[model samples]
Target: MAVERFPVEASHIMMFARSVGDPNPIYHDEDYAKGAEPGGIIAPPTFVQASSQYDPDAALRPKPGQPWFGSGREPSGTPRGGGGGGGGTGLHAEQHFEYHRHLHPGDVLSAKTRPGKSWEREGRRAGKLKFSETITEYFDQNGELVITARSVGVQTERVVEQA
Candidate 1:
């Protein structure tokens, strides 16, 4: 619903690596990473995409009284609608990423994210559903661009009918 920006630090990358159970020395060992094929310990591509400091609140979440379509519950008692209203179901439709350069420790990164596209569709069982796509850009401390990511989300108002 709102566009937000934030800075990324090396710790974020390290934490993400640890959380994902990636023991690649490149992610943790500076010397090992420096010796990697690219000449510098580069963060995993997936790590870069997953590494960010954006707040969940900045992104759209389901509101109260809404069906549990997998997005999240609203603090209030009203079913929150996403970008569009086909009922309140949500799903991760797609993700696309592009990397300009690799992220390293001590690199200060910044990101700006916003809802890019949205639409509704009819499901075999869920009836009608709404979905939104979000795009985020990551930039290095020097103002150089590093990576760009696009994530798709599907949402619906009612539970999908069982077959």
Candidate 2:
């Protein structure tokens, strides 16, 4: 997978804040943000993670007859998707983040995402399953690393039995 970077404009931060229902003045009011504890208008922690902006056409998908291309099957038996079911199961297993500094308007942001690790394991009911871990790094216009995020998703061939 290739890494994608996006510029962070004030509009993006404000739109994200509104979409997430965060009413903090700092996220909306420039004056209030400048006076806040952080010293400048900053995006909410969750806002940073929500900025997974990417080109819709640039997403990775399997080609035709490519062993279930887009079917969420990696050589292993893991399912990948938000549904958490066999053949098409995927879920956000976990998320970890680290922030070196807050992002402000006009800060060009770029992200590089790649497969970090993957494996298969036995599920209590589904028998065996596969999962993949991905790491995405965000950098500022200056090429300075600003944030790092790791996301995990489970891919299986069977429906994910509810716990």
Candidate 3:
């Protein structure tokens, strides 16, 4: 997904840090961060995770009633796993982030996502489960890579009855 721009605000950074229970002053306190290396306030390492939301296209946010990758099945109605919408059967197996440069407030960022890897494994209870990874790379206005994030999502058949 391509976005023209994603202006990063200090408030957004501070809120995200707070939401994640990160009390690091570098993310929220300007005076405190100014003395730190890099000389200014920097966003949290995972702040770029929300870059997808800046896209005009609904890359991450599906329309109402639309199925998402985490919906436990393909949009074509083929079940990806045993889960038939009984409950939350998806799992975030892993997450990784590589910061090539510090993200400062007021920097306009854009991101692109690509399919990373996929595999299947036997589940102790759900029988079989599928895992897929996606890589998103965020770049700044200067066309420099600021962050690369990899997220692994796992889906399995629902073991419980749907309401």
Which structure among the candidates has the greatest lDDT? Answer: 3
Which digits, one per residue and each the tens of the lDDT, describe model 2 over residues 39-94?
Answer: 77787786556554543334344435444333344564334335544444555678
Model 2, runs deviating above 4 Å: 1-3, 56-87, 125-127
Candidate 1 positional error at 4, Å: 6.9
lDDT value, residue 90 of candidate 2: 52
Q: Candidate 1: lDDT over CA atoms?
A: 0.66
Q: What's model 3's overall lDDT?
A: 0.79
| Model 3 TM-score on a 0 to 1 scale | 0.75
Candidate 2 lDDT (Cα, 0 to 1): 0.71
Per-residue lDDT value at 100 in model 3: 88
RMSD of 3: 5.9
Q: Where does candidate 2 have its weakest 10-residue lDDT segment?
A: 54-63
- Order candidates by TM-score, high to low: 3, 2, 1
What's the true lDDT of residue 44 in model 2?
73
**Higher-ranked by lDDT: 1 or 3:** 3
Writing each residue's lDDT as its tens digit, candidate 1 over 85-119 gives: 54445667788889888777667666777779888
Candidate 1: C-alpha RMSD after superposition: 5.5
